[model samples]
Target: MSTRTLPPPPPPAEVRCWPDREALLADRAKAMAELHRLSIGVPRLLLLWLLACGLAVGWGLVGAALKTFEESRPDALSALFGVIFACTAAGFLIPTGIVMGLGVRRDKTVRERLTQWSSLDRDPTNDARFRSPGVSLCWFVPSFLLCTLGLWLSFATPATAERGQETYADVTMLMGLGLILWLTGLLGIAKAVSHFRWAVRLVTAVPVSAGDGGHR
Candidate 1:
């Protein structure tokens, strides 16, 4: 990580003697783009999460086909239930392992992004720091809850096939949680993008001027 810092702003009196929109916008664009890049890591995380989810769903489909409840061939169904249970476990596990493995490839990228963000010049572009303290809280709370619930359900897979039967309740529980996490993340991204765009407007639209005979 680079310990570099952005050059500080000029003296208060000098900056206050201001005028042009174009110059202000240029400065605002530069700052916002940097912050925008820092947030890029978020999408990679999301993609990995979604892929894991898809893998889980694929197993669930296989499980559904093999289930034996309310059928005459109970023995065959029981054997099938064992197979289905095993499949489900393998399904979610593969994606999870892949994501964790991604930690190695993604760590340095994320770290560098954060490092650059730390060096940004303080300005309205930094509004993400303050915007939506409440929204941030709201997003995380549900995300945490759903993900936890999903993991709990996932761990109950073997039990789902005990005593020559299968119950879909646990599978449903996991699906519900996975859906919740997906929705929460999507909503968070939408809201964040909107808020960021608005802040950029406010910053660049504001004026910055130089008094007569000014030189950079």
Candidate 2:
């Protein structure tokens, strides 16, 4: 007589399909590509903002230089200045704001989704490096803070005549710095989105014990 032992049965099919890298990658790539494409326009938006700032400064200088023209026909000069300001806002500032807004929204959405997916295997201790904040935040936060301070200074009543002039100059400088910071932030965001596309590719390409659930 002989005794024989049979091997245990394999695990159920459904148990092997929870974390499918290929399928996750395919979905994530589609979402991220759309966002990355939008980010490409961010630098262009920054350039437009800078151009608008330059044009505004030039317009102010022209007005200041033509004091006689401004004093003689104050109403007409005011109207002309208004038109130029309106045109700049409509043609450049508004469009740039819209693009940046959309990019920010899309970036937030895609990053959140990816974070959720990555959490399945992400190590808790790696949060500082791997789960860091977006690059744009580094510049955007400080820029807005400076901008707010500049605006407040512009409105605040000065305690002395000499202080008023200094305050005005300080406000102008702070606003200018804010604009530069904003541009830097926008550029950083564009690069970050581009980098995210590659990260998505790498994550999806990783080898996992669980299959891609029939996704190629």
Q: List the residue pairs that clash in candidate 2.
A: none
Among all windows of 10 consecutive residues in model 2, the one with the lowest summed lDDT is 1-10
Model 2, 1-216: lDDT tens digits are 011111112223355342454454444344434433333334534643565465345434433334333344558766576556545545544554565565556545554444434433322332233322354354345445544554444344242325435544344434444454445444454545544554554345443323334222
Could you tell me the lDDT of residue 123 within candidate 1? 49
lDDT against the true structure, each candidate: 0.47, 0.43
Off by over 4 Å in 1: 1-49, 61-104, 124-135, 155-161, 167-216
In model 2, what is the error at residue 22, expressed in angstroms? 11
lDDT of 2 at 84: 63
lDDT of 1 at 176: 48
Q: Which stretches of model 2 miss by more than 4 angstroms?
A: 1-78, 124-128, 131-137, 144-148, 154-216
